[model samples]
Target: MSEIRKIIEDLRKNKAGMRGILAIIIIFAYGILGSYFIMGLNINNSIYYTVITVATVGYGDIIPVTPLQKLFSTSLALTGLGLLAYIFTIIINSFEENLHDIRSGRHMEKRLAEMENHYILCGFGRVGTAVYEELMKRNQKVIIIEKNDEKLEDIEEDDNVIALHANATEDKTLKKLNIDKSLGVIVTTGSDVDNLFIVLTTRELYEDAWIISRASKKESIKRLKNAGANKVISPEVSGGNDIYFAAVQPNLVHITQNHGIDFLEREFEILKKHNCHLENIEYHFPGIRTPVTRTIGVLDEEEKDHFIDMVKNNPEVKESLDVMYNSVNGVHSHWISGPDKTHVDMAIEELKKEGNLLGINLDFKEINEFTKQFKE
Candidate 1:
């Protein structure tokens, strides 16, 4: 029973490819051999007759004359008809299954395309699954790209979570997933080689995307990092460290288990605060061409010169404190403080009056609201 179940499962996953091959072989062998011996016909004539007979397209040009020949013809007709029925059943089932897969794949593709500022997880193993769970717990949108379809079969269905059965190393797959628009990618396949390939491919597709890769071997860590992975982790190393910590520092392990699990959750709040600061500025100053304003990090070099200078000189304008600069692409984005919204506004207005030197544009988050709007 177990063996039968295993075979059925394999067939279900493989789309009857092996069964189709075996059927073709049986049909050709039986057709040629049966017709040649029973009809006493030449190879070419026997094959032609077999084709017509099996397809139920019998032409009157070939007819069985002897008793034995007629008996064989009747037997062959029964066998052919039975085979045809079986073939039709398989074909129809295959057609329906293919149609289902087409629809499912298209839905996955559309979901992946619609994802923006999301993370692409390129594996479904233990480490990858852990990361996925943590991200989901934080309400982060995640699209999983795993080559193994069986691994994806039981995934929990959610709008923010999608599983794509595709090779991450393929450029077409990454492009179809809109890797360039993603915030980052995580490669956690068990193989260091596969992770390295995925990192390289993802980096090629999206230079700005943050990529984290898993390395199995100690020596492969540097290689993975050099291959464009922003962070490279060896599961073996982490696992060993975890075991050591659990043995020697049980209290620390408990603290980590209790607290570190929610680290990503806190990141969600931090991201929300940052976005609220930017949106507050945009909302308050509508006539300032708010769409043409940009945000920069507090630690940016440009901020040290322009933003810091203005914020330092004018203590009255303290509502917004982020600098607005135009990038080569005519758009730039950064973070600001909520209290400094007015300062940034006045600075932008002053710059505009001085003659539009910075050709900028607009940009603009919640927890449940944030997840619904931004998550995947």
Candidate 2:
């Protein structure tokens, strides 16, 4: 309803166009009046005759019997035909104008210029589509740049998504999207070369721009990073790793795939809190949790200092501290008693802020609960 109102408003924007439409309406009314009063026909028959004559149907059922009637009818038919031709011309011109707007991107230019702090997503292929949906779900501000006209048609007309039919590799297109004011950019084109170029162009345009790009080949990863991408992900490699893990560590796969990272974080924190008493110099973090065996990835110089002080005071606390440092490092944290789910989540988020630490993630709720014992 709102869109219809908007379209009507736009149609009326041209005063000449509205006047022409009004003229057509008045002419139709005149024809009906002349057919009824002047031609001495009944009102119903008068409307019917006028409509048919203007349409040029000429059924020949009703004849203008008198000489004056015939002359009046002939004039009405000719005038109606001329007006009909004019109306057709107006419709054609309006259609051409709209088509030109779509082709030239004039419709999007102003809207794009007004957007800021939005995300720019390049390409609309499979990967790009997934990213777009996820961003939409998160309620992020996103604008899509897709070159393929066929793919753009897939987007529903009523959807709130902003899609541009333009190549993203061009600097002019990026500028039009207000990339300089955007928070981040995602490049999901299948071609590594294209993704790299987009990253480079985006980086050049916005120095502080956060860019994440997809690369198909291993070598393309480093090149994309060098081109100024914050993160370069290879879907093939990640998919292969998932497959390998699913086969070798089926239980682990089920835990991660179904329960989510929160479940793991909560569970890990629980185990660590219970086992805090058994922290020895030869202590292991994941060994007691399950049958699986893997070396811990975290390295903490800060925790090492705190652990030495603990060993002299209470050797058990030092041992427990060692397991935490071995699991997650490079964070200022402190231990808290009787942790709940909320605290466990907050601690996990806090740990994540330290960024990637050796990529060896564990499922221990107690780990996070007791993980962050920091000096005030």
Candidate 3:
């Protein structure tokens, strides 16, 4: 019963097109009935007289004097004339609406079909915008599904993106965008619950697509991950990490900032050469002499600079750096080096002063400790 009601509602929504089709049918019927009545009456006038009489534009040239003719004329005038008016009106409105829908539908279908390996971003808020900018910088293809009209208006002018102003959790909308063919999906809406819903919907619809979601609360992280989000991030958690790193590892932060050796930049270079992690064996440091564990995070400025320089000078090194940078997460350990120890240290101190780390740090000792712990 509910399904029947839904079908009825859908039909109502497309009533305009149906009305147009009905109008055409009625017009044809009137023409056929008029032709038959004229032939039966044995009218001597031209076919123009038949058309005029049936159309209610009687010129008095062909009069229906016989009772049968009068009766038929009266019936046709009442029924056919009324139907003609109603059909004309309905058809005009219907065609206009149908034309609009058809054009828009075809355009959407064509665009979706042409898309391949694109990123399906499930919001247009601040975080979503940042993600889009980053993806655009890398020349990645992206499609945005945002419910907010104002937010969508902001991105409509961008040629690189295909924006769908609709609910992200709707299977219809996601399917229209060809989510199954997408490389990944990012849910960065303001609501953690909304993000989770989007993640769940995408996972269910396209089980192989990678999903990254944003969560507001700590508890939502596990749920989002379980819902098939490859990664779940909390803005609050990131902010807290930055604060803690500034307070605890001010020196390291300063070094990283001064040398301009950041994670994103390093990762970008590494992926250019080597596409995967398993292919690389050795990672060179800037000024450090000792060999570092694979799982250890590097905190010193000089060491980070050294690593950056090595990757910059060699193509293979750059490729490796890119791969590692792309793969590393908040949970993994990695090395960071700039040019000189003093410069690195100074930069780290500056970052600490500026509160960039969000209270997170990877000191030499901490790196060693984490590496040992993970190894064991």
Candidate 4:
């Protein structure tokens, strides 16, 4: 609605063009009335003369005879011709501009339809832009939904980014982006309310999508989570934490600042590079309650047999180990478990050294719960 109003106001504010158009209208009226009064022509004949004169198509059938009529005819012909040219120029330019907009719109729509496993970013403010840059660094596909045209302009030349100038809070916009086919959504609008709304709408459209939202206030964090965000981040909180970490945990801060691994995100990228899809891999990040366990990939018949033979002779590995299979991809995967974090680290380190020799990956973290289940 605001966009339509802005366009209308812009058209109304084109004083130069409007003045020229008004002059053209008045000149045509004068040509018709002057001919009717001075040349003794009827209304229809006067209008006919006016059209031909303005069009610069003098047929010689309506030559001005009287002195007053000839002067009036000369004035009308010159002024009307120039005005008509100006008007036609404006019309042609306007037509070309509209055509370009239409072509770009259709192209964007086609790109949106073809996008799969892309991330939808709602907002292009500071927070959003930072997120976008990080994702771009990792060569991730991202679609930006922003209401401000200026923000979209910043990414106009970026081929990897598809920006839509629309309200992200609207479900229709989310649907147009194909939320179900997207990998996740990030809402970083300036307003917490708007971010919450975007999160809710995205969640309603895609239940399994990983939604990360930015919150301005502490209270908004829980609200955003309730609205279906998988992760809620506050820049202020993160900044304060970084300051504190720098003072107390200097070494840890240095390692985090210089060599942040982001194990889960890296694992996904590695799997993607191997032609393995996210849906085919099951992952769980280690937390206080949840153990860090990730099922890296699936193997075919030959790869599975070779993997088993390589690890079967190892004394550290279980004799009758469990193998997981992804029915969707028709591939098998070997599972490893550890009793604790130290044991898990040792197992992963040892297996990683031979993972290449076995023609399979064995670098995944062990889930304590999975280990208990496996033993039973």
Candidate 5:
């Protein structure tokens, strides 16, 4: 049973290659030859007949005359059928494997395209998993680069998450994950220097990507950030903060209640050519109960016209139109903050009215719960 389990694990980790299929073809050919020679069957063109029969291209030129030949023919027929079945099964399995590879390739491509606004989390250990959970709560799209085979199994169960099992600092691995397009990257390896190396490589590849690293030692923080990490967090400092909080503000010592909002920070880039009018607007509204503030950026002539039409048609918006104009950048930027539910409804109403919004992207995550637990 243990050996069988090990075999199963190995099979899951390693896909059957072309060599396996070729081996099946060889076996089938040998079976065809055995059928021909074992029964001493004679034919006008034995080799040619065997080829055609094994190839599944039967011709009437070669015929079995004797009873022995007929019996051998029957055996050959059965063997041919079995070989064909085996060949087809192998071919189908290969095709399915190729299809899966293609699907995974496409998924990685899509993840790369959004790299400019996404995060790459390296390692999938306990700490790394916690970071991933927090990122998920905030509805952040992230690519997890882990090396452990066991962790890959856990991540594979999540259809929404993409996992690449490779060295996070390797250029080839980074390129596969489209590290250049990422908005930021988090290096949380157990080794402080490994995290520093990842940050250095990521910053060099994508200067704009925010590289946040975990430093295991107190002295490594400065070196990590200096190595191009935008921020270096020392676990010791974090532990110190927790200890201080425990000693002083025991009730508020929970990282989840205060720092929980950190996980709630969502960033979205508008999808081009979307029909929703208020799509480009970035609102910081927390929940449905909070009031929202609106800030409008510069608008083009067409957008300005649409805005005017929306304000004129909606009495509520007309009464609350603080400012409406184009900006120096020539693209309109709108800021809306309010009770989450009400503001979202109002924004949607405006979107419906103007038909100008392209898309409303969301990064709705719930990190407070996990962080609160961590604090405890």
Candidate 6:
């Protein structure tokens, strides 16, 4: 009984892995040969007799003749028929177990560990399907996490798709999907609260990962962003804009539809058609900051020239307070600009001894909200 239980467990875990199949093959071969020699039967007759006996349909026409022949037939019938029945029953049960595992998404766990830099798309509703289709067209590796089995059904038609039929908002599910190494994440579930929670969970797991989430309601957009989404898209807002653009500016809509041209390429092509020339395009993130309008002001007109003369040559003072800056010249890149911030304190301190720092700002990250929005 213990051995049978172990065999069943093995078959459940790894279908057709037990010694049953091999043992059946060996038994069949043994029975065929034993019948041919011991019963003094020809190859064809031996095969027919062995099969019929194993199937418990022994015909009188292929009867064993003597004691040796009858003994071989008895042994062959008992062993082959018993083993075949046992293996057949177990195989059927194993197949059903395998199907259950597949339906419940248990089989996906092994493959997730091998994936890195894949996309985690958490949802399989109408919006999620659209995102998935776009990703598929781009030939991206994506792992879909959808709770509804019916919603996940379409993706299974795609053989390469690896989907986890589970709740996306759960941390355990995200861990199973290997969210830490994912290149990016998309949350387009119907529920705004669920999407927001998934985004927060994902951010906690992998802080710097780029996450694009859908806001089912307009109010949820800001809430999702505050919860740590890199980009919170209100589908209603976006779809309305697209519909408006398609109606009002069809050509612009047509041009933007080509996602490969979502960058500056579309503009270059448009300009080129009318004999316009495009210089090289450079993307400066955290933008090239303009210097402050006022950094050094003086209430004392008397000491203005004296202070200027002292600090003119020593403008780049080393004693200014530690702040982030772009270190193109050995300066640490953490420099935050807006020299207006520190010059007052520096000037007050500078009154004691050396020249003051006529401020120059430091590094600003590329694609900062200011730089992204306010393009000159």
Best by TM-score: 4
Q: Give all TM-scores, in the order shown.
A: 0.54, 0.43, 0.46, 0.59, 0.49, 0.41
Model 6, 1-376: lDDT tens digits are 7656755687656645556767767877987898778887889987888788877788788887798888888988898777878878876776677668677564466678777656778888777776776555334467888899887765653334687778998888888877776667788889998998998988888887778888889988899989988777777867322211121111110000111112223332333233222211222233455322222211133443354444334445322211112111111111111112133233223322322112222134432333443333
Mind giving the per-residue lDDT tens digits that candidate 2 earns over 35-154? 887789889998898899888888998899888889879988998898888767766676677678777676577677777656678988887776666555333467889899888887
Instruction: Please give, for residues 1-376, the per-residue lDDT of candidate 3 as tens digits.
Output: 6644543454467665466457646654654555466435333343455466557897876666777777766775666577667656655665566678789989877887788766777887877776776555434567888899788876643445788878987778878777776666778888987888888888888877767787778899999989988777777766322321221221122111112224534443432322111111222233333433354232234654576677668788777656653332212322232222344444434445543332234454543443344334
Q: What does candidate 3 score on TM? A: 0.46
In model 6, where is the ten-residue run with the lowest total lDDT?
250-259
lDDT tens digits, residue span 1-376, model 1: 6644654554556655466557657876777787788788899998898788777788979999999888877766777787778766765676676678779888877777788756778888887777776555335567888999998988886877888888887888888877676656778888888888888887877787777777889999999889897777677767422221121111111000011111323422443443322221121221223334333222323533454456556654322332221111112222222212333344334334544222233222111222222222
Candidate 5 on 1-376: residue-level lDDT in tens? 6644544454455554344455546655654565467535454355566666666676866666778666766666666676667656655665576678779888777766655445678877766776776555334457888877778786643434677778987877777766665545777788886787788887777776667777789889889878987666666656322221111111111111121111111111121122112212322223322213353422344765576566657776654433222111111223322212333445445444543332332222333222233335
Listed per candidate, the RMSD to the true structure in angstroms reads: 17.2, 15.1, 14.2, 13.0, 16.5, 19.0
Quality of model 6 by C-alpha lDDT: 0.57
Instruction: Please estimate how well model 2 matches the true structure, expressed as its whole-model Cα lDDT.
Output: 0.60
- Candidate 4, pairs of clashing residues: none
lDDT score of residue 298 within candidate 1: 25
Expressed as tens digits, the lDDT of each residue in 1-376 for candidate 4 is 6644544454466676577668877988988898899878999999999888888899999888878888988888898778878877765665566678889989988899988756778888887787776555335567998999998886854555788999998877888887776666778888998998888878887887778788889899999989998778887766322221121111110000011111333433333333332222332222223322354323444654454455555544423232221111111232322212233344434434433212223232333233333334
Choose 3 or 4, whichever is better by lDDT. 4
Better of 2 and 3 by TM-score: 3
Better by TM-score, candidate 4 or 2: 4
